[model samples]
Target: MLMFASSRVGSVSAGRISNWIGHRYTIVVASTIFLLGSVLMGYAHAYAVLMAGRCIAGVGVDFSLMIAPVYSPKISSPSSRGFLTSLPELCISFGILLGYISNYLFGKLSLKLGWRLMLGIATVPSLALALGVHRMPESPRWLVMQGRL
Candidate 1:
């Protein structure tokens, strides 16, 4: 899980060797794939499918986990940067909390669909995150670097 985050986060930093071609797009695409893969993994009955889904999800997780810290500070003001830096840790805890709550709830359902439901539940957040990104502004630092500021 940590390694997956590393990959996602790492991409958000400098990106890739061929990123000069379209790194930002690649990261977004990869993130989407990861999110979808995670949801898919939960429902996957076959071991191979589950593993593949996990791997894809890991890639996407890597993209988001790595990207935030890599770019957040560059755009944050010094006065509030410390708080901003803590957001990732907070997010991690929140995610874990949510997962535990959800798993506990699903575990009580006493049905096959219950397990699947728990895994598929992640799709909602992934969709929300994707939409939120589309609605929000690009990084101010990135804009400034591009001379849009």
Candidate 2:
């Protein structure tokens, strides 16, 4: 519930953050936060720690979710805007499918190790996004908004 609740709050506030810091920075920040949360959850030994990690990861999830569609259209060519904008949702659905598969595979492992591995695996994509964001161009609209265009 904390995850869903935090996502609602984060989704609501994401636009303000992107407006202030721009899309690239927002994505990097979101991924970094998620990476931290994943690490915390993977290592968490207490219920409180697990909940805190879930809340943090939730915020990160929503921030990225809100910004990606908005950013995609800005960065792509006009001809590809629709397709590009849809990619985020497609990727999310794919990720969910992968999660289900991973859950099934991990479910066979010892209980403690299985859960931690599932949570810890999330850090891979978050870390990848954090590192890879530096290579992505900033949204042209955002650059205009910042007077950097």
| TM-score for each predicted model, relative to the true structure | 0.75, 0.94
Where is model 1 more than 4 Å wrong at Cα?
A: 1-14, 17-27, 144-149
Model 1 C-alpha lDDT per residue in residues 1-149, reported as the tens digit of each score: 64556455546543652134233443466557767787777779887777777667766766666566655565578998988888888988999999999999998996777877777777777766666655444666556556666
Q: How high is the CA lDDT of each candidate model?
A: 0.66, 0.90
Question: Model 2, stretches more than 4 Å misplaced?
Answer: none
C-alpha displacement of 125 in model 1, angstroms? 1.6
Q: Assess candidate 1 and give its lDDT.
A: 0.66
Indicate the TM-score of model 2. 0.94
Counted clashes in each candidate structure: 6, 0
- How far does residue 105 in candidate 2 sit from its true spot (Å)? 1.2
